[model samples]
Target: MDVTTIIGLFVGILSLVVGFLIEGGTLGSLLQETAAIIVFGGTIGAVIISFPLKTLKKVPFIIKYAFTASSSHSMTTVENMVELSNVSRRQGLLALETQQDMYEDDPFLSEGIRMIVDGVEGETIKDILNREIELYERRMLSIGKVFETAGGFAPTMGIIGTVMGLVHVLGSLDNPSALGPAIAVAFIATLYGVASANVIYLPIFNKIKARLDDDLMIKELQAEGLISIQYGENSTLLRNKLMAFIDDEVKSESEQVEDVNVNA
Candidate 1:
């Protein structure tokens, strides 16, 4: 589980509720089942209509991704690639086939190594893996777009709910005493919509985009690492080349300070 995501969520909710309590607001004043049903139901209906049912079905899995560790394997994968490069240099490329079990933790890296061991041409390997990368990117984007669509629809749905509530209030103008609370309840849907969009849906969409970018970089690095090994690039050079893809991640704080000083 991702502690950062959990902590961030807890912090966001706690801040809002604590501040609300400090302002003399009770939880009961904000708890409106009708407003929740209207905002969430309308938003979900709009999202389902916006996207295909098949893609919507994957929402739970994609949302879970936000609360989980990133799937980026660039760091470990570079090490593995360097080891494979050494093996190819000392023994031979074909010797990699015997070491398949060693890379069971990462199937994509293992598959790339298998291609190199099978003596696949550099161009052919690049073409196949590039296609794989493109397909993977499209799939991830589809999932991200689901949350994107929900975020887009949520605020609009909230406004619609408010309008519906106001229409009812206008129809019952005889109950002037109920008007104040009715107006407050009418805007709760808007609050729910805006809060859900900013706090949940949009955040998840952006998180998926960032994670997918990292994942694709790892895949691209694997493709290049495998191809370089197949072409018999020097092991040290190949390791350096792969590590370059993740420069920001590998840079130490001291190196970052030096960079800041240099830029200054």
Candidate 2:
């Protein structure tokens, strides 16, 4: 589903195969099940030992995220804030009480709405929202670090597999033909390690980081818009402020609407 992830995998494998072919190697030479088992098994075992069960369970989700574009809630946040601003202007801050269920479903929106509904001052709301954002960012970064660690260790495990293969080759050195196969097996570990690290693990880590950044940006916009609403700013002013989070085309459209209304 993630084109980038798919492309990255395809490119990495293609490059590896091309490089191998250029070096007078064939696919048959690299087909080593024992090497694969060693690299994959050892790396996974080490990862399990390093991380908690709950954290480990999140690996697949993290992998999925790596390939998929982030689900940006900026537009949703802006829409909700615009509605809340209208409600506040029409019926005072207490009017938002009935909409609490909708707000509660979205934690970022819910927290900001709660701050305003609770009569928190704008500055205090900013502080509270910022603190929450920081906490979430830290948690997200920690999750990214887990995949990074996996990427780092995968190659090392591959080397370990290579060493094991070399050991077998050394024992069979008396047979030259056997040495070639053994060496091939040993090198396959390195290939798996490099492929997994470059193609999968590292890319996932970067994707999570990017997604976290986008999520944080959306939360920040929500926080700022909520604070502006809490201070009884005009809907036009609040809308203008929130529009900064959107693209130039959207901003232009919004401004055009304002221009038309002014003429009317």
Predictions in order: lDDT: 0.85, 0.81
Candidate 1: pairs in clash: none
lDDT string for model 1 (216-254, tens) is: 888898899889988999988997788788867464653
**Could you give candidate 2's per-residue lDDT for residues 1-264 as a string of tens digits?**
668868877887888888989999988887788878887878778888887887777767766766677655666677778888899999999878777787565787787777678888899989989999999898667667777887888899899988988988888877997777668778889989988888878887887887888888788888888888888998888877887878787667766878999999
The C-alpha local distance difference test score for the whole of candidate 1 amounts to: 0.85
In model 2, the Cα lDDT at residue 59 comes to 69
Q: Model 1 reaches what TM-score against the true structure?
A: 0.91
Clashes of each: 0, 0
